[model samples]
Target chain A: MNIIVCVSQVPDTTTKIAVGADGKTIEKNGVKFILNPYDEYAIEEGLQLREKFGGTVTALTVGNDSSKDILRTALAMGADKAVLISDSGNSDTFGIAHSIAEYAKTVVPDLIILGRQSIDYDSFAMASMVGELLSLPSISMVSSWTINGSSITAERDIEGGKEVIEASLPCVISAQKGLNNPRYPKLPDIMKAKSKPIDAVTGASVPARVTTVSMELPQTQRRGIILNDSEHDITELVRLLHEDAKVI
Target chain B: MKIIVLLEPSGNSIKRSSLESITAARALGATSIHGFMYGGDANSAQIAGEYGLSDIAHTPATEYSSTAAATSLAQFAKSESASAIIVAANAAGKEIAPRVAVKLEAGYIPDCVGLALVNGLIQGTRPVYAGKARIAVSATTAMSVYALRPNVFTARKAENATSVNVRTFTPQLSESDTRVKVTNVIRNEGKLDVLEADIIVSGGRGLKGPENFHLVENLADKLSAAVGASRAVVDAGWRPHGEQVGQTGKTVSPNMYVACGISGAVQHLAGMSSSKVIVAINKDKEAPIFKVADYGIVGDVFDVLPVLSQKIGAVTGK
Candidate 1:
């Protein structure tokens, strides 16, 4: 069996996002980047599949120069190979999916795995789109998964409950949290992974069907009103909710 | 331009978020708003029509997979000459919209919180970096598809209800399109899902152990709100994964979010920061949850929870 995990490099959750001078993208100066948190599960799941089923795991990412660092991290996490697919120069989720599909066409791994959605974009679109582009079944936001021969069963989150889905091999699976606890790269493995050369593929560019016009920060809130004040009381809190906030 | 909304039902009626999508369409200057659903009949159409729907397309409800559903919906939208397709940012809508957009080779936008029409072109303000920042995007194609974030826009009802026009649609779905099949949908009995609950009372590790969750649940019972848990508590197995509220957990935008004993981790804040009104109660004064909270009470949960619950019960008479 062969497995491929798609990952993305995003701003660290703690990094404060500032609107760039262009007003369309994040200001990169003094920003820290990390592998998308959810993608860690995807990378770990890939390693687990390889360990259990005896297969090669390949980590793939899309972005510019900053993406290589994440690919190296995947290498440290025991992914056998790493590929960096250029962003295909489009902001369209479809374009991103197609670009990844282009690489999948070459590898044709038995399974394609990814986090449910990247924290940065949060479209939750790529895994399904890749499934469509490749004509493979995709089970999304899966918490638990099992395989028997070629049959795959995935347990995923629905609104009120969980659903069990069945699909054959050669399908797509999007990893949700609780799938597995990812392993931190040991110092030795990290050093070794740093030396491992990563393959770079360029210009998978599908034209973006949608384009960004501008961006703005969410309006800052006034300092929180601490209810520990003498003017604030529990009864007043309830009344404020009813008459002032009107949320009740 | 003809605007279409892909409707997802919350129990018997249209999901509140889908109604917001309809309101989004109307805000885009749509006079004739059409609703598209995969199943149900004239009865469902009645509910949708109440929310500004002039016409409804009822496709034959089959056990179609996500791929089949997306294929059928995209084809239907094309046949009807839909200029814009909007859906709620729910599970099905997020899964289906990109497929439709890719299939139609149209513009795709998801998780849009606000929409505007600039010179007859549709544009939206969507959060990126997990609500850390928001950007405005516009469609460069003839047909654009969007998934609207829930609770961002108030769902306003359209005036002057028109006669409902219901159309039955037979999709050309083949077996090859649905190889992935959902065998069972097992809903937790008698529990209100956090996503659908208007009021949520969440607890954190401050409760110490599973035995003390009763405090949170007891308060929730008084307020008639669903119970939620912070990631720390969920990770410790003190609660089921379903009740977890954070980046890894269900994102909730309830009218009122009461955080008890929760120190707002960024991961947790990513999920609930969009809530309309946030109230945080914690022993630690420096807990990050206080940042986004509309009201903060720096008091010990054990000391304050029962009293607040009792006081609120007295006020609400529940």
Candidate 2:
């Protein structure tokens, strides 16, 4: 089994985001970047597949030089190799998808896995686009799975419920959270990853169908109006909801 | 411009979120709103018309299938020359929107909180960096697809009469297109899920144990609200992942969100800060949940939950 896992670098979930002067991006001066939370699941799943099926797991990502941090992290997490499609375009979802599909053509792996969505763009488009480009079956937001021969049985969330699905191999699986607990890299592996060579390739230049016009902060919530344990506060709260907020 | 809105069926009527999508499409300068139902009854068509749909199209769809439906919607949009395709940012929509974008070779923008038409282009503003900032995006295509978040846009009265023309279509499909089928669906019998619920009562680690979640469930039952859990509780195995509400969990924009003993982590807030009214009950006065709550009661969950549930029950006569 040749398993390929796609990952992305994003602002740490805890970072305080600020709009850049350019108005089309975020200020990254003090913000720390980490591997996308969902993509960690995909990388871990790839390693597990390699362990069970006795083949190589390759970690792939697209970004500029700083993205190497995440690729090294993937290497530390037991991936056999790390490939970075270096591009500074901050390309739209379709452009990224085309770039990944361009690289996928070279490897022709048995399985391709990625995050359900990137936290930054969160467009949730790449895996499906690659699947469509390759004419392969694709499943998104998979939380759990079991590989059986060439057929993979997966379970995913669908609105109010969970659905069990089965699809053949040579498919794209977009990992959702709670699939598995990703293992932390041991000190030795972390040290080894620092020495591992990263393969770099130029990303395909596909024009973005969606262009960023600008960015701004969302309306901040005001300080809450805290109510005490008094019955009057509760009664007033109910009245305010009905008369003022109108959300009751 | 012609805008196609995908309306999903719920019971006999269309999903309220789909109506909100239509409402959103209308705001995008749509001259004619085309309602497309994956599968539904006559009642859905009437509901669509009430929500500003000029015409309705019904297509046969398998349970939880997107491939065939996406292929057909692409054909419809092409034939109708739709300027944009709007869909509810719900499970079915998210699952199918990308596929539709791929098939139609159009731009796909998911989780838009706002949209508009400018210079004959569809523009969208979506929350990014976990709701801290919004990205303004303009689709540089003749046709684009978008998924609208629920509970944000208000539905307006349709200018036309209640009656509208409805059409049906059956698209040809190959076995490979629909190789993945939904074999089984697992959910809380008869209860609403957090994503689709108007009211949600969520518990956190402050509840102490899994058994105490009964306090939340009891109140949720009384108020006809869905039961939700914070990441801490869900990670601790106090609740299932399906009930988790946070950045890595689920994004909800419910009418009312009740936080019980939750400290309101940034990740959790990202999932539900869009709720219309927030009510937080926590013993700690410094709990972050209080910062965003529209109404906050600083009290012990063990003492306050029972009283709150009783009060709501009395009001609801449940």
Candidate 3:
């Protein structure tokens, strides 16, 4: 059995997001980057699946030079190998999926796994698009998965409830939260990951359909009005909601 | 211009997000609004008509449950020469919209909150970074696809619009095309989903014990709101994972959000900060939630919740 997990590097969640001088892109200066938190779930799931089924877990990522750290993190997390699609050019979710699908055509993994969505853009489209591009069965927001020979069974969260779906092997799945608890790399594993082979590939073209004009922070709110007055408290609050905020 | 809105069947009726998409489609100067419904349900056709969609295209897709729906919709949109395609930002729509966009090679905007036509091109605003910022994007492609956020737009009755057209489309799907299969479905009993509720009452670690969740649920019942919990509460297993709202959990933008005993960590704030009206009830006066809240009640949640619930009940005689 062969499994591939897709990962991406993004600004750490703690970073104070700010617009660059161009006002269209994120300010990368003095910002720390890490493997997307959601993708860690995919890596862990892939490793566990490999351990149970006896297969190789290959982690893949699409980004520029800084993305190597993410691939290293995956290898450190117990993936057998890592592949990095090094293309600095901006690609939409569709383009990223196309690149991954194209790469998968070569490796032909039995299962392709990815996070439900990237934490940065949160487009939530990669896994589905990859499924469509590769013509593979795909499920999103999957909480639990079980494998029995060539057949796979999983539980997916819907709006109101969960859905039980069964599909054969060689499928694509975007893991949701609580699928499995991801483990941190031990000191020995971290040292071993440094020697693990990381294959770097390039020359992927992304069709551009949408252009981002500018990105800016939302307008700040006014200083909050503290209600120190005791007599007309709730009434003032309701009035503020109705008249001032007009939210009611 | 002909506009096509993909209607996803949510249980027995069309999803509310699809209705919002229709509202946006109409605002784009669409002369004719067509809705494509998979599985050929008559109730779905009727509901589409209520959303001002005059032409209804019904296609029965048994093998291709959700993904095939997108293929069929793309075919319909191409046949109709739709200028724009609109879809709901739900689970199915989230999967299908991008696929359709990629197949059509159209400019796709996911999770848009607002839309308008500018200089004959569709312009959309989407909240990014978990609602910390909004980005306005314009489509450079010939056809534009948009996934509108759920419950953002009210569904209005489209009077005297009864004409429905049902078209049969065979989607191209393969058995090997899907990588993941759903094996079981478990539904929670007796509470509305936090994402769908108009009013949400959420608790955090400050609530302490799992037994004390009744305090939050009791207030939620009185206010007719859904109950949610922070990541801490969910991680501690005090509440179900579905009810967890934070950066790592569900992103909710409700009309009214009530935070009880929640300290409002940045991760938690990212989920509900987009809510229209926020009310915070906490013992700590300096909790970050108060920064974004419209109303702040400085008191213990156990004390404030019951009092508020009783006062609301007495006011409404419930």
Candidate 4:
């Protein structure tokens, strides 16, 4: 079995993001970039599958030159190969999915895995889009997985429950939280991974189907009324919730 | 313009979120709103007429497959010459809508909180970078699809009763399209999911141990809300991962969010800052959760929780 994993780079969750002057993108200055949190699980799952199934795991990403940092991280985590599809990094989710599908067409790997959703856009649509483009089965938000010969069984999360899905080889699975604990690369492995080869190929350009009109910070108007846990305060809080806030 | 809304089945009726999608289509000034379902009959979907649906399309199916469903929906929309497709951004909708969009060569937008008609096109407002920021976006293609986030759009019943025309058709599906199948469904019995609950009671590390989680559950029971947890509590094996609310966990936007003993991290805030009302209870006055909370109580959870729960229970008569 051969496995392919998709990875992305995103801003650190703690970083304070600001809308750029163009009103369409984030301000990159002073923002710390790291491998997307969920993608770490995808890479880890790929490595574990390859370890058990006796196959090679290839890590793939579509972004500009700076995105190779995540590829290096994947290599450090024991991915056999890393490929960066060099593009302008301004395309929408469809364009990115199209690029990945185009690359997968050439490899025809037995399995493709990705994070459930990118934290940046939070579209949660890539696995389905790529599966459709490749005419393969797709399952999202999978928490547990098992493979027997050519058949695969996965337990995935739904809105209020879990679905036990069955599919065959050459399917797409999106890694959800609690899938597995990712392993950290050691110092020696990190140093060696920096020298690993990354194959960069030009990505085909596709026009964006969606365009951003404007961007702005969420306007919050919290009341910020603070009170102690005294009896009087608790009573007053109940009164406020009943009459003023009317939430109860 | 002809608009098609995907209706998800919940037992014998449609899901509330799917009804909300119909309301969204009505808000788009659609006079001809159609409801489509894969496994239900027209009689089961007659309630859609009360929510401004003029027509209903149904296809019977014994198995579940996302690709086959998308193919059927895309074909139905194209046959009806529909200009827009609306679906609730639930699990099944999130999986099916993108494939339907790709099949129709239409631009798609998911998890929209606001929608409007701008110059005969749909403009959507959605959160980016979690809920830290929001962006106004529009589809460039002639045909468009929008997935409204659950619990945001209010599903209002129409005043006048409108008759619905129901149609059934056989779908075009191949062997490959139905390969991925749902073998079984496991439901969390008698428990409300946090994603669909109007009110949520979430606990954090300050609860100390898993044994004390009864305090959180007791409060949640009084308010008839779902139980939630912070990443720390979930990671500590105090609660299941489905109840965790944070960056890597589930993002929730409830009408009221009550945080008990939680020190809000930026990642945690990103998941729930959009809530309509936020209440934080913590011993530390300087906990970051107070900054975003509409109401803050400074005290220990053990000291404050019982009294607060009793007072709320008395007020609500629960």
> Comparing candidate 3 with candidate 4, which one achieves the higher lDDT?
4
The pairs that clash in candidate 2 are: none
Clash count of each predicted structure: 1, 0, 17, 0
Worst 10 residues of 4 chain A by lDDT: A234-243
Off by over 4 Å in 1: A88-90, A221-223, A229-232
Per-residue C-alpha lDDT of model 2 across residues B65-120, encoded as one tens digit per residue: 56666777878888788888998777678777888887787888888888877777
lDDT of 1 by residue, B55-157 (tens): 8777766464677778878888888898999988887787788888888888888888789888888888887876778889988889999888788788888
Task: Give the distance in Å from residue A117's predicted Cα in candidate 3 to where it truly belongs.
Answer: 0.9
Candidate 1 residue B255 Cα shift, in angstroms, is 0.8
Ranking by lDDT: 4, 2, 1, 3
DockQ of each: 0.66, 0.67, 0.52, 0.80
Q: Scored by CA lDDT, what does every candidate get?
A: 0.84, 0.84, 0.79, 0.89
In candidate 4, which residue pairs get closer than 3 Å at backbone N, Cα or C atoms, i.e. clash? none
lDDT of 3 by residue, A1-248 (tens): 79999998887777888887877778889989988888988999999988887889999998877788888889888998989887756777767887899899999999999999887877888887888788777778789878898887788877777788887777888999999999999989888888888898873787767877768788747335654223255456556655776644
TM-score of 4: 0.98
* lDDT score of residue B215 within candidate 3: 88
Question: Worst 10-residue stretch by lDDT in candidate 4 chain B?
Answer: B38-47
Task: Write the number of the candidate with greater DockQ, choosing between 1 and 4.
Answer: 4
As for DockQ, the candidate ahead, 2 or 4, is 4
Indicate which candidate wins on DockQ: 4
Q: Which one wins by DockQ: 1 or 3?
A: 1
lDDT of 4 by residue, B14-75 (tens): 89998899988888898688889987555778788898787888877888888888999999
